[model samples]
Target: MATLPGRRLLQRCAAGARCRLLGTVAEASPPREGDTIYVKRPASAATRDETSVEMPMSFMTGSVVGKRFYRDATVRRADDGNGWTVMLDYRTLKSPAKRPLKLPSRTLAMAIAAEWEYQESDGIRPFTMPLMKLACTALERVPVTRTKVIDNLMKKFHQDLVFCRSPDDNELTIGVHQKQKEKFDPILDWVNTEFGFKPVVYTSFFGGKQDGELTQAVETVLKKTTDFELASIDAMAAAAHSLVIPLAIFRGKLRIEKAIELIRLEEDHQVILSHYLSLYSGSCFSGLTVQCLIPPGR
Candidate 1:
């Protein structure tokens, strides 16, 4: 069975992959006094009706930024290297649209929508192959919409996450977002089948089994919390290393570059767990660590 810790490791990889895939690389400037601005769907709440969604590009303020926008964008991979060089420029025109462009081939597309969207949110998107591989871990084939795409990724991510919540024992437990529950199920099934992932198991002393009360209570608590998953072989190692017991990181944003170091902090596992086994304890990490997690021990 994929252990509890393994589930979280897997989720992090899939989440990072998903984020990197759609995150656009963009920069923006505050709107000037009179320029018209274009916004996509679900307009910002701060604006009034007619102008609720539309803002003069000129009236923008604060860190209003622009992200990588392709008047037209294209991508092609190097025959020998493991990366892709994406090309993009401005101009609205149609490329051959009979068939979708395949990977390793240059890609181009055009939007024929009545009104095109202009977005200001910015961040770096994930690279392709990794995104595809991560998606394939659960979905037999990719679906077309953004919701479907996110669902597919979450399914793969959830498979290993259940281990952290099994009812038989209690170590630590976290919940999934309500809106994101369906997206997480397929992943749970996949991880359970392949990694021996178990559900959150716990027992409690109660007055009685009257009125489905206990189950309701358990469900209520689970519904309120959030946690990462753990499943694959690689995740197994990351989870074991993370048993920081007291110092392990269970929350907060830890990026890839720092993730590597975070995993390393617990690599030996014993390094931070002195009472369990000291001989194999990891060497002290020079960078911020449990030390960062707490104030100097009293």
Candidate 2:
């Protein structure tokens, strides 16, 4: 399974756990904010007490000030080698855990610095800074745990949501088939023509494995992606529960709206019904109308 970087790692506590940095369990008080700890878990009794714990990575541990802290946010070339780093007020920025924020690509570094530059005195919104998050994951997390994350995402690819279809039944059988062709077929055709790969589509949730050739082709593409790209793809794939959908969207073959439509294909009938009801029933009783007016993230 693909293991996410430390920043994405979860926090947990168990007795007798050892630390990653300090060899022995710190017989100290509970860990404070921004602290790293490893809770060891042995695989077998033969290797009992051999410490191996996943430590949680930190990000943005400092409190946000009302005003921007930096006079300027710019991209700077790395002093050690190739690659780039973001400079905040002439000083190099660091990750939440005090690690330097070095990126493999100049474009990636510039993108991150842009997020910092655009931040207002109001507050820091880390959630809005996806590029920065990806940079951190690439720098601190991916280098240590690349293999696990790749394997986990590969496993998820086979059971992608796009590969499964809603089964046809007596009443909705014809409608289901029609919807599949109308909505899903184009996406499949595009992949076949674009990638020279046609993924096997199933008519039921229990559908078996896809063609090995198609899976292999996908793996090949993913293997070539940078750590930043892979992290973003893994995230989008998990959210959509389908590697195909995210791949298409990322490559510009599909848009986010269309991908969302495909993900919710099983509810197409209900959506159409809701749309028509909203159109005919006027604004007062239409949930869809009310929802649209509410704006996003409400």
Candidate 3:
């Protein structure tokens, strides 16, 4: 499927550097003096203009390492009017590589600014700012790691969750298989129709292989995707454990809620089985509670 129209606009804006920032202003509460946050530059930037790069440092780890130092989070149009950026008071927000966090969509910029605005004064938790992380992955990582990312995703595709069917013989399998047929079959059908190759389904816990032509076709689609789109697909694919689901979502054939339901279908059935077994067989499985199995918000 082609990239979504909105994503197309974003890609165009990002490439041309010719979009105007237009959206609600995002502003954070005032800040207090604290330790400065420092992120290391990616090694790849060494070949580029030195002046273009910002803070230079060594590698660091952890999501919540930094303390809040900026007074407020806000959005501003770039000096060149090329795109919008999230500003930490007078300091511009940069990616981990110290590259400008230029966003093609003002709506996205605002959302990212909100993430920063929501940070606690004691710590700047990078894990909480998903939009900002995504933008950084798109801008700093995707271009350099495109092949590796796609290759890893393709590795997951061979044993994708949707391609594995539960055996229909067992009582538990009966419900799981029915659900799979009802929910997953349609996705497989769409993949068949879209890629012109039927995906292989098997009962093996190890997973099954798809056709070579189908793999190549899916890879081609991924290869053609824009950096932002690929980054998004990568995130969704990792979450769903099935590339087909993300492709369906991108194609507008599946809603995110439906996709989540599908992803959790068999797992939910297992939870039901555990409950039944616990009550009837006088045996309990540790940590089999629904709340633990299925977290809030699906």
Candidate 4:
């Protein structure tokens, strides 16, 4: 059924056209805007049949801008023996207390534009996109020194940042942007396989798991309850210490393991915590100062 056309240029088309296979092509009529048309049956090279118009290549130009918005990302040294690090290189990372991060913003913008031009011809749209994020074992390149970068990141994407590191430079890069959201699984899998995130974090300014029995108690609470508490006494202080606790202020839709995985122990009576890591973590507690969940301290 060649609606709005006598016949289509394509002869071997499936339609209600009462035509037979021809060995020659036919000249057809030009098409108009906003017209409904279909290919005709058996086409030929020798027929000058007036039909539909040929479409211009410009009709398909291609792209989505970007996809997803993120604030922080985690990276680790492929061979530097460093645990985990976050690389911030966005205009937002230009903090007053930290060195301004350098991102390929201009370069990325150009890339996005080119990609969109190529993809727009198809039909898709996205927000922000994933790119390469890097991490350095040395403190010389921390995005911010005042607080844990993960803390701030959780506020933004509410999803854990995943990365793959370069063995030589410990830098991470995304092979492609605008990938399916499900693609994130492989990155998390890689992080777990490569980094092996154990539930322990240290109290040192760097933060990591310090091992022992309080670790056991922490594990038990997490296994049985949705959340827990942490009580500590500054073992180095003359008066008291602190501990680590798990807080879920805004972890609603976000996975538990993504952000604020652990908090310092607070008070001196008891402590509680849990692991979103499939509820799998061998807890350990050392001396640390814990304060109630408040923006002032974290």
lDDT of each: 0.28, 0.62, 0.73, 0.24
Off by over 4 Å in 2: 1-57, 60-68, 104-106, 120-123, 168-177, 193-197, 249-252, 255-269, 277-298
- Using TM-score, rank the candidates from best to worst: 3, 2, 1, 4
Strongest candidate by lDDT: 3
* Best candidate, TM-score: 3
**lDDT (tens digit, per residue) of candidate 4 on 12-46:** 13454322211112232235332212222225534
Q: Please report, as a residue range, the 10-residue window in candidate 2 with the lowest summed lDDT.
A: 17-26
Runs of candidate 1 exceeding 4 Å displacement: 1-64, 67-70, 79-81, 90-193, 196-200, 203-298
Candidate 1 lDDT (Cα, whole model)? 0.28
TM-score of 3: 0.73
lDDT of 3 by residue, 181-224 (tens): 89889889999999999999999999978899999999999999
Candidate 3 clash pair list:
none
lDDT for residue 168 in candidate 2, whole number 0-100: 62
Task: Give the C-alpha miss distance for residue 49 in model 1, angstroms.
Answer: 44
User: For residue 184, what is the lDDT in candidate 4?
Assistant: 34
Q: How does each model score on TM-score?
A: 0.20, 0.62, 0.73, 0.15
